[model samples]
Target chain A: MNDNNSMAYAQSDTAQNESAQSSPVQNNSIYAQSSPVQDSPSYTNMPLLQLNDLCKRYPGMGSYMSVFHMNLIIPRGRIIGLLGPNGCGKTTLIKMINGLLTPTSGSVLINGMAPCPATKKVISYLPERTYLDNGMKVSQMVSYFADFYEDFSTEKAYGMLGALGISSDARLKTLSKGTKEKVQLILVMSRQADLFILDEPIAGVDPAARDYILRTIITNYNPGSTILLSTHLISDIENILDDVIFMKNGSLMLYTSVDSIRSQMGKSVDTYFREVYAC
Target chain B: MLGKLLKYEWRGLRFPFLVMMIVLASTTVLTCSVIYTINPNYNEAIPWYSSMALMFSIFLYYFGLIGCSIGLSLIIVIRFYNTCYTDQGYLTHTLPVTTRQILHAKLIAAFVADVLMVLAIAISLFLIIQVTLHHILSFIPEFTYADLMWEISRGIGEFEEIFGIRIGLYFAYLAIYSLIGTIANIVTLFGCVSLGQLYAKHRIIGAILAYFIVQFILQVLAYFASLPMYARMLGTSYNSDFSFFGLMSPTMNLMLFFSVALAVFMYFANMHMLTKRLNLE
Candidate 1:
């Protein structure tokens, strides 16, 4: 009985530590999922990224803080999901991580360093919108990525494009929207970097394309690489995610492991998502 | 790394640059051919050198204006200046290069392009002169190379002579004026974009209006300041044996200094606004 009690206490302590590591001042409710982390053997690894007191406010939002005090901890080699509806600050948060948007007042650290050129080198990002010049051919786009990102893999990118049945000679404008999205995913996943931040990777694509994208992401990204994927299509990507973060409005609702959420919610993640995000 | 930056810059500019070169080459050939045809048989004798010089000078004036307005140099410079705050700039700013490095790359590429344009124009003029003018043999009695070369060598023989001081000074004055003008134009463009981008909507309209407003204010201030400076410089020139060079020197220096300072001020203002208040929705 004492051993069991000690194990339970250990599990709670580990869970607390994990939550704390994600974002400073973040407290896990203990009743939420991911309660067994303290009892797990692998509890000491440091988080790859930590968000502290992040916020973003739009004009005429009525309140001072639009996105108020967001904190998150992301571990290495994990597919972390940021699930939210439109205008939930998921895109803003992702942009902040990629250094596209500056935080109002917060710090985000990647591999113990702030988002500098070195950090950027290890973080491959796929923006929600198409950022590439539409006139460029796929080959030119690849060459451009090759120029800017030292860690980018041209051969791997080409291989991924080939697997996706995308032609390197195809102009970005000429490709269908779904094909363009797939091309973006292929380019992003081809990088052998430490972190991958994919915003709405499968939002506009069809189910088949989305499935192919998820599979491609699983196969192409290095095993040790961390991916932070933000999307509203939670039901489709739930199977591949190791962890899930639910965001409502501009604040975090819940962050827990997939297995733990499954056990606690006593249903598939889709059902839990519907229940949690129900209007 | 600089080479890579330049390579990308050139890649972005290659189509425009190629077209500009083709246009310049064609225009140069056409103008020279027309002039030669108009004065047919003149090349068989000693050519009317002064008349040809005047015609060439007139061609150069239009050429310079056209080149400045629509050439690759202007296109690239304007685009470079605009890139700091355009929608396309979201990619540019996120590149691994430093903000200063980006600025330096744009400026250096622009300067290089400008130099190339100047070289092209110079070569075109040389070719026109070579093709249309009478042979040196035909002009031997009237204008010997030895005499011409001696005329150029006169200033070196006697220090007091200073035979071409006015010409040298005029070139210097014109160069300074052109440099200031180019810098001012680029800075104004940057300032407009930066200020315009700070707004949430109607950014392009705001930018255009802000640019005109700034220019109008500067012109008013310059006009007031120039009254005194002009009076002093002209007064000095009138008293000094019509030494327009000496009088204009101070005025040119002041304008150049003012223009440079304005450009630098606008550049910093733009950079500061961008670094802090950039509202990239």
Candidate 2:
């Protein structure tokens, strides 16, 4: 709540310099042509996202930091996994990144600027819960997205609905829970944003749906955009991730490449997560 | 963006409002028809059940007319709470619009909706009164609407002579007072809903408690604001020279100032909560 001194908006140069030191992906070969993680450190190549000394706390929780002083630097075109245990501030981090919650301290710079409406235009977010009104139809939601986001593709949204056999004309309440999740995912994936923050996107769906959802996410996102996904089901999304971030107690424990985790420890990301977050 | 937000907000509300208006209009017509059928020439008492049914219908009609205004306020408050502080808030807050735009849109929509409800109520009341008075006055031979008009105007003219002010000006003051008061009440409700987010759990209960606390504070402020007016009236009463107008302007000004101040305060408080302390589950 101390926004006056708690947060600062650094120029895009500040993010460029910090990103050069801590690019999420150490190697760019994973998605050879897609990610420009190896771009030169300059204003033109400013990181897609940055967090500097970010902190968030609930006043009623007696100084409990939901997201403590954590810093992150994400370059464009990489899919990063944000893995954390329960109450480890994964959603809190995502909420701040999407400007749903103001940071108690520090800064969240998207494309080197603060999280404003301008930044929001480039970030497509799928929250952990269903955010659509059940009274509306799937088609109405598609229309709403198209109305708000210039980059939204109504044609792609309807095509995905058709593929899933979900009638866009049906009211959301008339659909099953899994179908609603798919509808949300389709709407989010249809956007041509610079960053896609998907929080537990696959948690509510069947395993079959999870694979399709992940695939849809991988294929639908424009190459220039970065997908910062947070989920506990690390195995489901491990393969698609170019980089991985582990958080604990509201702090960043590690930020490195999926290749590094597999090569250095000879363990899959899921197995490593099991060991790191074991209670 | 503000326009877009308002457009969707109205679209979301249009169905419920339409249903309410249809119900209200149907009730008004039924009440007038029932009144129209009452026998103005009957000298003997009617059956107890029949009389009771007629009285009950009229009572229900007036009750509904009053409820429409209150219902609109409740509807807006609940909508504000649900869309801004519930699961739906995830989409609301993430929209590519500033918090100020969102709050202003909500406030404007609520204000406009309530104004429409008040207008509906006013029209319904006028219709009901005209119908009921028609039945009552039918018994009087050669009594006309012009006669009723003159009666009311004469009373207003006498009051104006004593008050030394135009009756029209007095009504204007009352209208402005009401409009400002409505804005203030709606903003306070929004502020209470925002305050509910302070609770880590049980936000609805927090909102209910905040509403009671706010109402109590407003009541206390209102009482204090009226003290000077009461003193002026009380002093004039002892001299036997009291004019109601002596109380009108000062009371109107005091209440108007308090309402404007309250509205401005709560507007800022709600915006601050949305921007800095929003809690969504």
Candidate 3:
């Protein structure tokens, strides 16, 4: 068989094995690649994000690099929780995947394509803090996103806003901190994308608001879309996650399926994260 | 993309732009009144027009200062103020837009605002000239009936003679200059702040100190860098025999090109740091 067919066969085999371990892919996820004209109409399996030998370095005191080489792969249709303490490179990894922070060496592929403007179109991101301009009203902010993103559904965005009881006319500056975070989340979740990288989505919220945010994430996430939710507060999101990627000091310490961790490590993901990252 | 950038830039500066307009309008009215009061026979006096010319000359300096101040303030607001890197960088770097696009948007917006500021001053001058019609006519009765048209033509001639270039070229060069100026400030601001914010060792204080140090070094470099251009503008290249506009045309054009190149260099450096090495928490 040719290179294309061989690659397709290998991909399918990997997907089948992965599916056996996790939830099945759901319909409605935008698939850009075709699987060599499927003869039996079977869905082809593909990883949504693959990080190979990724490295980032910042010059530190007298020639040391702050962040070292690291690697991890995030599969499709699973909530992969990235747990680490302060300065562990969780945010950096997320930023790299979203194309904000580029790797010093190695490569990262989003849906098998190099990070570019086109790849960004399929990645939804909610930053840890409010990034929206404080001067803008909710309506203006909505229109701004709508102008750029073709997949941004204004109707759905407003519906979500209404459901959350947020005023469309309220300026971002006037909103309370929790409310502002919700506004940002609304904007992020509004886009139907293949990958959603939420960097510390619930870090600043109270327990109640954190629960609300978690619920919002679970319900709003498009099926078949991969999610990499990075947070130190693992217990809150532990029940929903299918896998956990633990990082420390700019290195990947552990990457395993949740069930495997429970079966082997014999501890909850939260307990595992705390033990691994505890100071 | 440029248009969107300009739109957002304008959105960001709506308040400042309005304030600039009001300042221009007041200055225009005040200047006209002062000139009329000084020369009651201003309409008949040719020398009275000198004051109007002098006002524009003064405005030229103000334009540069205001442009620089606004650009500096914007840099602080967008890059330095509050000085949190983690949250801000996350949002900024992931906007589904290229780093270059973001830079272009900011540069264009700042340029447009600066241009409008200059225009506000120019428009105010035009209105004053129009309102002082009778006074201008009475002062130079020999050039009456169509003296307004004559003054306009003369003004155009004077601009060409003094600068030794066409008005179109002059305006284009100015636009380029303002754009580059804005880019420079933005780069310096972002680079320093990002460096500070990302460094786990020290944050805002370190960033600010680094910024000042960089600024001082750049200023020293810039002084030497500007020596050739300053000599050109001040030297014999400023031909007194030529029309007012022709006297310094080459120097102005050269300065414009230099600023643009410098700005582009700074722009790339800033983007490189932001995209690759940003230590967003």
Against the true structure, whose DockQ is highest? 2
**CAPRI class of candidate 2:** medium
Question: Which candidate wins on lDDT?
Answer: 2
Can you tell me which runs of candidate 2 are displaced by over 4 Å?
A1-45, B240-242
Candidate lDDT (C-alpha), each:
0.67, 0.80, 0.65
Per-residue lDDT of model 1, residues B121-140, tens digit only: 77877876665454432444
Evaluation by TM-score, superior candidate among 1 and 3: 1
Better of 2 and 3 by DockQ: 2
Question: TM-score of predicted model 1?
Answer: 0.80
Position A98, candidate 1: lDDT: 65
Q: Give the alpha carbon lDDT tens digit for every residue of A1-279 in model 2.
A: 112112321221232223322433213223222222344233254677878888888777776677767766788778889998888789999999988888999999998899889999999999999999999999899989999999999999999999989998899999989888999999999999999999999997899999889989988977777899999999889999988877766766566678777876788999978866665
DockQ (Cα-based) per candidate? Answer: 0.29, 0.69, 0.39
**Which of the two candidates, 2 or 3, achieves a greater lDDT against the reference?**
2
- Across residues B32-120, which tens digit of lDDT does each residue of candidate 3 receive? 66556545462556465666665774575357447545653664345333322546555555666776776666656655565665566
Report backbone clashes per prediction. Answer: 4, 0, 21
At residue B186, candidate 1 shows an lDDT of 65
Better of 1 and 2 by DockQ: 2
Instruction: Tell how far residue B143 is off in model 1, in angstroms.
Output: 7.6
